[model samples]
Target: MEKFKNRWEITQNWQLIFPVIGVIALGYSSFKIANAIISKFGIATIVIVSILCFFLLLKFTLFLFKKLENKWILDQKWEMIRVFIVFAITGSSSMFIGRPIIKFVGITKENLNPIVYWFLFIIIGLIFYQILLVFFGWLFGQFQFFWNFEKKMLRRFGLGRFID
Candidate 1:
């Protein structure tokens, strides 16, 4: 508990790259699976797999929420967190995809007011960025706590911090 508190105090930012990498890898895997199944079957297969994956992900998400509640300081609602994740991914990806298309279509200050484009883009990007920062910070901190705790425990048992 003391170690967890100390680590949280020392590093409370987007410091851990592993969790985000893992999540992205999982998402890429899901996309590939969905595409392959869709190709083999049809749009129906894609929809079914997507829905199934969503539910499964939701279940895992809730489990993570519960684990965090038990082990960490944050007491965020699982439903709210889940909704935020969904909205962040959807909104960020849409803007990310749309920005290039808009630019490709020669959207300019004369065509569409620069202020309007900048306002929407900046607002959405900031919102998504803040949400991801909070989520990732909490997740990384939580895992870091357990990881350090395990190391300390093993050292206490004279395991020499490594297994042969």
Candidate 2:
């Protein structure tokens, strides 16, 4: 318990538990996603491709973290990892929510031109992403940060007038 607390840089005893829970959840989700992809692509091909993709993704995430490190509210590096895990879950949730809506609306590639289908899909996904960003951020105790980010994203999309 002491080692876990020290490794996560959590000063409070209660705070130490959440990061462990977050990591376990993240690992489970990763495993499920990897298994799904591997089943689709076959074990040998997916194993090789997944390894390469994992390293590339790790590198890119680390680079992104380096750039945002100074600006991020969390002082500890491990906290950022927890935040990233939340962000990933939020993104996946958004996609999961968006896909069924898109299908229900008959916006699939079979029903529309491929480009139009994708465009609509992306637009809907972005809307869900904005909403989920705040919800998940609140769950992860970063609501203020994601709320500001959502506002900035809306402003960029020319929806600034709608934001209060």
Candidate 3:
């Protein structure tokens, strides 16, 4: 049988789907940890454990991505570079968000020690990175749609066609 061709075919790869699923799983685990900590230790504990869970979630995500890189399908080196870029963007952005959220939850300058503050920042950074991992994974999995959509938009804007 002959195969058909399309401009966005590369986006159909399963490499993307797996990562998105991983992200969701990590988020759920973090949520569960938060709930447990809150139940047993109160809101303060929730703040602390939420920070720890973020690190654990990011570690889990990185481990999974490492496994994917070892597999033969997607180019591991390229995938890792892209993942790191995404991690950097998301991690920084998350700190901006997480810091405020943490403060809102009562872990403020007055209440939290310097060590605890730094720990929260690190954990929140990881949490943000994991969130991006999942999101980019899904987006990569759906590349075909985005690719074609971009092409269509470009065409509408009088830009020339984009090749995959």
Candidate 4:
């Protein structure tokens, strides 16, 4: 426990939730991917594949952390996990929220051109993602990081005039 806390610079017990949730989310995602890929296999096979995928995903996530550490200004290493969790939640939520919105607006592949429908779906999702990113970041106590990130993204998209 001490080692883990020291590793992530966690001083408060409440701050431990981010790393724990990150691990559970990663494991659940790995298991779901393994099940989706190997649905025909037996339970034993699925477990093995899920374990393998979990390690692979963990390695990939760690690689990303190492790569992003320099680029991201964070108070502690644990905060990165919270930031990632916010991003994950915002992305999935944007698509989930956008689907009902598109349906409400009478924009579906069945009604609109397939290409146009998909384009609109993506655009709407992106818009919601932008809004939710800061919202979730604030909820997760990382508002400054994501707010700055949002401004940088807008700047890259040629919308710096609106940011000030």
Best by lDDT: 4
Worst 10 residues of 3 by lDDT: 1-10
Q: Candidate 2 residues 14-97, lDDT tens each? A: 666666665466455545567776768777776666566556565776688789888877766667776787788888898999
Better model by TM-score, 2 or 3?
2
lDDT (Cα atoms) of all candidates against the true structure: 0.53, 0.77, 0.57, 0.95
Please, what are the lDDT tens digits per residue for candidate 3 over residues 1-164? 01311221223554454445545655666777798757777877776787789788788766766776655244333344344444444555677778777777777667778898778867766556445555654554533333444455457756644432
Q: Write the per-residue lDDT of candidate 4 for residues 1-164, one digit (tens) a residue.
A: 99999988999999988999999999999999999999898889999999999999999999999999989999899999998999899999999999999999999899989999999999999999999999999998899999999999999999999989
**Highest TM-score among the candidates is held by which one?**
4
Q: lDDT by residue for model 1 over 46-114, one digit each (tens)? A: 767866775677578557656765554333332234333443454556567656655776764577778
**Rank by TM-score, descending?**
4, 2, 3, 1
* Model 4 misplaced stretches (Cα beyond 4 Å): none
lDDT of 3 at 151: 55
Error of 2 at 42 (Å): 7.7
Worst 10 residues of 2 by lDDT: 22-31
TM-score of each: 0.32, 0.73, 0.35, 0.95
What is the descending lDDT order? 4, 2, 3, 1
RMSD of each: 16.3, 3.7, 14.7, 1.1
Which is superior by lDDT, 3 or 4? 4
